[model samples]
Target chain A: MVQEDYILEAEKLYVSYNEIDIVRNVNFRIRKGEFLGIVGESGSGKTTLLRALMMLKRKNNDIKGNVRFQGRELIGLDEESLRRLRGMEISMIPQNAVTAMDGTKTISSLFHETICMHRDGKIRRRDSDKLASQIMEKMRLEDTGRILKAYPFELSGGMCQRVMIAAAMINNPKLMLGDEPTSALDVTSQLQVIQELELLKSNYQVSMIMISHNLGVISRIADTIAIMYGGRFVEYGSHEDIIRHAVHPYTKALLAAVPDADGKISKGLPGLPPTFEKEMKGCPFASRCEYCIPRCRKELPEDVAISLTHRVQCFRTKELQDDIA
Target chain B: MTLLKVENLTKRFKKNGETVTAVNEISFSVEAGECLGIVGESGCGKSTAANLISRLQREDEGNIFFEGRKINGGFRLKPVGRELQMIFQNPQDSFDPRDTVLQGIMQGALSYKVYSNRELKEKALDLFSYVGLKPEYQNKKTSELSGGECQRAAVARALICEPKLLICDEATSALDVLVQAQLIDLLKKLKNDKKMAMIFITHDLPLAAAFCDRIAVMHKGRIIEIGEARKVLKSPEQEETKKLIQAVLPVR
Candidate 1:
């Protein structure tokens, strides 16, 4: 595909906090209406990378790279331009619903504010209530009247999240960024939320970048997967490639650690990710990798393409694939 | 034999001049060395049942028998708290932020005969290793430990009194996958070695399938279905159970 085909693209993006690189040179592209899943352990810089792409970084961090949205340069864009791009063009759904929405405000008022922000007085105050209820009905929320009147704390966690998702879609953005959107919910509620997201993707044709720590969630939702470790994308490939034929040790270990639905427990990976307080050299996963060679500890590996879409950053990825085959 | 029996467990909370039933007439028994998982969504009353059984919250109507003896008021006092321990969803909340790991764990045995400082420290050290932590962690403050370490410390604290029944109220939900697996392994070891009965309350179906011998599916303050874990997951009769099973993203 040509570069113009991708709606969003990040090239050599790096984010540093107090001179410590949290997100290393990472690159990816999201084609129109495509869902890309980013999976990693906590502190793997998945959230940081997402924030950087959206230009939502806190003041303390220094971001270095290029982000293109709809063939336009996004990085180093002025705040006014970035603000115009956010929400109306690129929306976000946060992890915790209870904390994401204001507890003091009712769901209806929250929707009114969001709609008014993007609509720019085109949608009157009276119409917002009708629009909010219509959106709630679309989101499959029952008793829309009662739900709109209820405060975030008064409603259930699942309900609050559905409302949040509805609020994000009020502006009808082309892209959605969800960071652990369903992690706080129960299984049934999680299923409901996931279904709503899938419906939005299929019916509304909304492209999304979902960040999750759970491999199962990523596998179930994402068409393509990016496995991150420490501060880098160790492997990026199609969902089947990552799930059935992952070459990176971190990705392999992650898949192995998930318990089977048949009630069988897999061996847990030992050790934790290296703390990035100091400058990092060599492979970040070398300390925890089971098949680490001496070279892995001494040098950083380059990204090698197994296929057009499948890329791995490991010195021994070929050997690992050969052994697996 | 049943280590704990809960009969007609019911609890109601009165708020804003309206009474809402949290747990309604739920009955179950836990065999020694067995884990019974109560799987449900947030408002399903699973956590309420755990609280009522552990005597953290008073049940409006219920009979809780610990080894054939009924337990009532002042259950948090000696012998009762020691025999029936509960681990919360956020393990850090259960700990006193100002207390050291040794101090927090030794507090679990306060009901028993007074222990010398050295004896308490020795016991705490033993429990540290028992929950897969280094003995040196006993000296660390609760704030210094990571999420997994705090949870291990919480488990050690719960087991310090050598409880007959352990109630884990979504204890592993806040942990990572690897740490959660390690905690499950430790809990399994404790169940096998000590013959301790556990009530594992959680919202994750696949996790319950892996950890529990039997499962009770709860919905809106009712147990919609209860049976062997594998059987329930394989051929769920109740609509709630089917939905929950379908919701689980199958791992292999």
Candidate 2:
């Protein structure tokens, strides 16, 4: 693909809340029609990174970063401009469906509002209704008319989530940001939602930046994976590279923690991640790293280039590899 | 010997003049020192069955026999609470937030009047070590500890009473992956060391397969299938169980 194919880019991003950094020096790029996965445990700043990319940080939160969409700056843009760009060029599917959608508004009303906000001219209700049915049909949503008439509370969680997806896609944004989209869903429902997302990605050619704690869910959809820890990207690579050869200790620990269906229990990492409030000088994972040396505690490890597509931040990757061999 | 026998257990809740059957005639047995895992999705009634077995809720129709003694047939039962204990999903709110870890565990033993004040304190200290908690956490309030530590405190409280059966109702669901592994290992060790029967209830089939000796698959308030962990997980006979297994991520 050509350089113009890249749709979104984050360069040396630093986001903080009330002078406390929640995401630090992060960098990544998304190509047009490509799916990128950001995986981490809770408090790992995955959500913060997504919010920062969307310029949706809370009041009093300081963001020192550059987020470019189609080679244009998005950080210093005004609310009105951002709002205009949102739902037209970019959209977001928030983590909490219950809170993201209005309980009183019918699914149809929400869809109508979203479509009208992005549409250039005064569109008629019939046109909006037609658009809503089209997107709902693409999402495999059954009983579109009934769903549009009923309130959010009357629908099941799975149906509510599907409606939210429809509402986000009704505007046909180029880029979509999903935060833990299926974390709250059951296994069957999760699979169904994932299938719908896959269908949307292929049929609409929409690029996505998905944030999830479940690596399995990420593995199924993401083309590239970025592992974050303590507000930093400890590893970044293609999904195949990261899953097969994770060089960072934190990434390895996360992979090992996933339970296998063969009934063999792998011992997970021993300690928790470092607290964000505390000042740290060296490696953030040193306290929990089993192979931590004195140098690891004294110097922060730089991002070591393992391959053209794979990179890791770890001092003992080679040593760990030799031991494993 | 069978530690507990549950036969044709059923429970129904009346909500807004409509009857919702939670557990519809599910039957299973637990052998001494065996770990039985009940796997199902939310609202599948596995937790309801756990509550019924612990006697936390009254069953509409069922028979529960503990150590060959019938206890759930409308017979006025004595203090059977000491013999069967339950560990809830959220460990943080399971106990009094103001109480220390030691105080919580000691309260369990003290409320049963099983040990004297001094003996209870001593036993609480010892149980903390068994659950991988340090002696210093004895004084730390429940709110001060992390998720895994709070769960350890909860386990210590449940085990301090020396119950013959421990029912973990999604005890590890709220924990992170690493912390969940530690808790599962700790439970395995405790079951081995104490020779206690356990009912591990969870929705994660992979976790259940790892820790359980036998598995029971439940769907819509029914135990659809039951067999050895490997057998049931490898080739589930019921269609719902098969769909659940298929939905799970394949082991790498």
Candidate 3:
């Protein structure tokens, strides 16, 4: 693809908090209308990396990287420009709907505030209500009157999640960031929310970066998948490449741990993911990897490419695949 | 032999000045050493049923028989002791924060007054190893352990008294995939080794298919379908069950 065709790009990005690097030396790019999924265990720094991409700041955090959104650097942009770009061009759906929204405010009040803030006097109060109702309908949420009058606490988790998605789509932003959007919901509600997200992507051409811990959830929606471990991506490729031709030991272990839809109980991966508290010299996953060697414990492996769209950072990717097969 | 029998079990609650039927006249039975799964979405009254069966909640109208004798609410005045035990989704919140692993587990055996302190400690250690926890974990507080480790500890605690029926109420829902798999394997092993019957409640259809010998599909506080796991999965008659089966991700 051409450079101008890319909607977002990251070059050698690193994020640190309290002098400990949480995201290190990462490079990424997403084409127009592309959906990228990042999968990792808890504390793998995927959430931190997602926040850094949007330039969301935290206390005692330091970020160094080149983040380009539509050919403009986002790292050092002024607050006023960022405010204009946030809801208009880029938006986020937070991790949990229960805590993300205010409990005291009604759904209609929140929607009115958002529409007025984004449009800045261009849309009248009556039109804003009409627009909000239309977006809710597009999200497949019936009973608009009942939903609008209800508070966040009155709605179920799934309804609250759909409301969050509707709020995110009111402006029709080009990019949407979802952090564990379906984790809190049950199976049926999860399917509904995922289908709604897929609809948003297809009908509105909204590109997305979805962060999740389950590969099953990611595989259903993502076009491209990245397996993150410790503080970096262990493998990056197309969804097919990552699912069928996974090379990294961590990636292979993750795939083997998920229960199948056909009711097959998978042989689980042994041991827990390591906690990265300090700077490390070698690969962080060496302790749990079954195929780890002396060299793996002594030095970090470089990214080895198997195809144009597939790459893995492992010392013995080929041998690991052979063993698993 | 039938270990537990419930006939016309019903529970109702008042919400916003309206009487909602949380569980509406459900009937089921469990055979000795058999696992029965109750699969449903939220507000389907699966948890309420479990609570009523375990005597954690009172049913408005129902008949519960254990060992061919009618029993009232469990664990009170009946001296059921460890005969019935329940495991919840979040074990961390259920535990006392100040208690150590050994203390938490011993509470089960201590309630019966059947085992000496030394015997309980020995049994607790054996259970710790059986559930895949190390010996050192027995001394740590609940907050010090990870979510998976705490769940494993909860299982060990639940089995320490050697219950006849284990009720797991969405016990693995809060865990990640890897931990969920491990916990299921552990539960399967325990069921076979101890010959214990179980009432497993969950929202995941595939998981119920894999874990239970028989499955019951609940919707709107009613059991719409009940049969062998394979039979129900192969030919689901209820629209709710079909929708749930379709929602599951296709396993590669």
Alpha carbon lDDT at A296, candidate 1? 91
Window of ten residues with lowest summed lDDT in model 3 chain A: A116-125
Sliding window of 10 residues with minimal summed lDDT for model 1 chain A: A117-126
Better DockQ candidate (1, 2): 1
Instruction: Provide the TM-score of chain B versus the true chain B for each model in turn.
Output: 0.94, 0.96, 0.96
Q: What is the lDDT, from 0 to 100, of the residue B210 in candidate 1?
A: 85
lDDT of 2 by residue, B141-185 (tens): 999888888999888888888889999999987776677878888
lDDT of 3 by residue, B1-252 (tens): 999999999999999999999999999999989999999999999999998888888889988887687775444524554788888999898789999988898777786888999999999999888889888888899888888888888888889878899999999888878778888888899788998999999998888888899999999889999999877787899999999888776524
Off by over 4 Å in 2: A1-3, A117-127, A321-325, B14-18, B73-78, B97-110, B116-122, B134-144
Candidate 2 residue-wise lDDT at B157: 89
Worst 10 residues of 2 chain A by lDDT: A271-280
Tell me the interface RMSD of model 2, in angstroms. Answer: 2.0
How many Å off is the CA of A178 in candidate 1? 0.6
- Give the fraction of native contacts in model 1: 0.53
Which candidate gets the maximum DockQ versus the true structure?
1
- Per-residue CA lDDT of model 1 for B1-252, tens digit only, reads 988888988889988999999899999899988899999978889998988887878888879888888885555545477888989888788899999988998877755756676787788888887888877777789888888788888888888778888999999888777767778888888888998889999888778878799999998898889999999877889988888777877543
Pairs that collide, model 3: none
Q: Which residue runs of candidate 3 sit more than 4 Å off their true CA positions?
A: A121-124, A320-325, B73-78, B116-118
